[model samples]
Target: MSQRYPHPSEPAPEPDSALLGVLAAVIVALIGGVVYGVVGGTFHVEISWAAVALGFFTGYVSGKAGGANPVLQAAAAVFSIGGVYLGELVIAALITSQDLNIALTEVFLSHSGLVGETWDLLFRDKFTVLFFALGAAGAVAGVRKGGAR
Candidate 1:
């Protein structure tokens, strides 16, 4: 297998030639989602999901944007985190009722098994599954030397 951690200057071998340049971004997003799951723990699915979504969007945008611009990718990443955390904070802050505040935290903490509770359903798990599938598809296509048709 090729060595992981290629040098900073060496351009990477394409993961999937069809998409051309989205491979690395997808990989990074998968990493971010997995990290979100690990750090979010089962109890804090929202936080974790938020993190994963942020990462996924960032990666997806980076891939489509072209030009290998790290700064744009980084900006996308920041927006993702902001989407999750700041979004939560804003919602919580908007709850003027003391009882509603407590209920919100409780409901959030309890969300997982329920259909729409944990962000993992939408964010972490879904994104991870998606990227893994995409990566595998890319790798297979790459192995066949199908870069951008």
Candidate 2:
């Protein structure tokens, strides 16, 4: 059997770095959080499933960028949690904005205490805790799957 050689014109693939993975995960977390918030706010209901997507995407991106590292996995999990929290805050801000007839940005920036309080109330739901756990699990699973590449 003859072994095939790579084309001379093709460049070698770069090695993944943990730093890159963490950075990518952070970016994904922020974007995912915003998207989750927007979707929940638009429908006037909190969609728990989006948290899973956010976690999975964050982990997948991190693993793909940084390879199979424990640090990356941990970072993915942490970021996923933060992302969910951020989404809740955004949702609260959006609801407040609509009810108070204020801008979303204004509510977020100027009335953070109100948003925080609302988030706390929302977080008290048992479903929220369950979804948060599911999101963390999804993130870890995604990291393992993506890192296998």
Best by TM-score: 2
**What does candidate 1's lDDT look like per residue over 45-83, in tens digits?**
345335545455545544453334434344444434433
Per-residue C-alpha lDDT of model 2 across residues 1-149, encoded as one tens digit per residue? 99978899886564579998899889998999899888887876667679899999999988998888778888898898888878877888888889889998899789988888877776658888776776777788878877765
> For every model shown, what is its TM-score relative to the native structure?
0.31, 0.87
Candidate 1 shows a clash count of 2
TM-score of 2: 0.87
- Residue 23, model 2: lDDT of 91
Report clash pairs, candidate 2: none
Q: Which residue pairs overlap in candidate 1's backbone?
A: 17-147, 17-148
Model 2 worst lDDT run, 10 consecutive residues: 9-18
Error at 54, model 1, angstroms: 2.5
